[model samples]
Target: MIGTLRTVVLDAPDIKSLAAFYADVAGLDEHYADDEWITLNAADGTRLGFQRAPDHVPPRWPDPAFPQQLHLDLRVPDMAAAVEHAVKLGATRLPGGGETFTVLADPAGHPFCLCQSDGDSTTIADVAIDCASAGPLARFYSELLGLPVTWEGEGGAMISTEGRLPVIFQEIADHRAPRWPDPAHPQQLHLDVEVADVDAAEAAVLALGGVRLSGGGDNWRVYADPVGHPFCLVW
Candidate 1:
């Protein structure tokens, strides 16, 4: 494995507002904060972060043109109450849902799913990524994070780690890969992985079908997984 998964970060024009929205709706606690970044700790040990992006462009899901590259699945015992609560927190309902899951857009315009869960309180169950093929991306992340593939079928797959939330892959018919650093194709979200040795992890990631995108600093470097989703390896 290249490294341990750190935080699932979302790009937002206003980091505080986006972080506040998730903190309230998902019941995550404040872990850290700064002008440009804010992170929250989920009940299951997962960390969610919001990064400041002044020129952020929100995705318009159900429309392939402005795709939702990745989204969180918040599970709650009461689906109706969860949906109502989310809507009250500046979330807008998006068409299409079933008894088990409902879709909504956060104030930042990022799409997320409110899933009917057995758990009593609201919690982040999974971080879902849109991909052209589920198997390959799932495999890439599985090796990178050292998470096992818990399920695979029906154009989707999931990798689960014991303490943190699982990451699921969904095959999108019209998936459009992002060309980040170019605002025309913004990366709405990304994963940050923590590694002991940045150089060694970089080698491991490249060997595992990841491409070096750019350098973050002495301790961190940006890379793109096999399917072009950007991620960072931090020491």
Candidate 2:
């Protein structure tokens, strides 16, 4: 039987940087940090993990030519402040004009969003991504999301933190990178992260094990890990 969503796994050049980024952004303390993986805790029992990838490539977004396969969405108090903060943190503004939402890139070049809402609560609801290696991916996410690796067997890997949200990384050996806007090769899923400060979040991400994939001006920035999975920081 399937359970609730727990943690999201991201591929990166450096797991430490990615974990640090999420840890600071989510306001979660670093539960574990090592060369192989890092994990952060969320209030809702959800966790985020960042795994090391030696050969990583940053993803391109909105271009349609390169296309971002997966990304995350973040909720913020003020859009303008969030955007400004992300830029200082090392995020690149994408071509999208800020309206109801703004698009930004993480250090890995993966796309994520910043949204404005009047809600008083600040919490993370989801974790999403796609990867070729499920075992490694699960382990990576477990550490990043502060989730424990559960159900480790030949079938695949299942992880959960706080015993509520259960994130599963199914084995997909023949996984192919999706091309953006192609429809034929559409992105399967993405992630949304809530952060206090955009710039500080980026810095923390870098400090942990993440790398800035692309950025310039005050628009947006893209970042990546050692493995190439992409995530974004917008300002």
Candidate 3:
């Protein structure tokens, strides 16, 4: 395995405020925080981090110009009540979604889905990503993290990260790849992958079609997957 899914990071203008917003809405506990970054842990063993992005730009969903690189799919017990609570907690419901799921933009303007769930109180079900092709991206992550491609369909695919969290890649007809170092099209969401040997991991991922975006110093380096989603290799 190249690395493990350590944490999903979100770029936000105000790290503390956005971190608190998700913590309040989803009942996640703060794990670590500072002026630049904040990490939170959910009950279902999901971890998310908020990083300070001074000139952060929110994604314009349904628009190829500015795309949401990734989003979280939350499972709520009561759809209506959950929507009401989420709206109250600074989540704005976006227009155009089906009955089974309600699209809501978080305080930072990242579009996330509240799927109908009668199971848990409010759990992060999956991390869904928009991609041009589901199979290739799914395979990339699966092989990188050593996770299994548990589900596959015509237009969608899923990779299970053991019991920590699973990722869903939904096919988008007009998927737009983010151009890093350019604020015009930014990767609103990315991941921090923990690894044992940074050099070995980098070599493996590069061989797996991961593009090296920046130089590695000592602990970490940046890379974009084959589909242009940025993820870090942290040792």
Best-performing candidate as measured by lDDT: 1
TM-score of each: 0.97, 0.53, 0.95
* Model 3 residue pairs with clashes: none
In model 1, the worst 10-residue window by lDDT is 213-222
Candidate 3 residues 28-107, lDDT tens each? 99999989889999876689999888889898776777788899988888888888988988989888679889998998
Residue-level lDDT tens digits of model 1 in 1-25 = 7788889999999999999999999
- Score candidate 2 by lDDT: 0.57
lDDT score of residue 87 within candidate 2: 71
Candidate 1, lDDT over the whole model: 0.91
Model 1 residue 65 CA deviation (Å) reads 0.7
Go through the candidates in order and give each one's C-alpha lDDT.
0.91, 0.57, 0.88
Ranking by TM-score: 1, 3, 2
RMSD values, in order shown: 1.1, 14.4, 1.4
Which regions of candidate 1 are displaced past 4 Å? Answer: none
Q: Of the pair 1 and 2, which is ahead by lDDT?
A: 1
Error of 2 at 208 (Å): 37
**Per-residue C-alpha lDDT of model 2 across residues 185-206, encoded as one tens digit per residue:** 4333333333446677667656
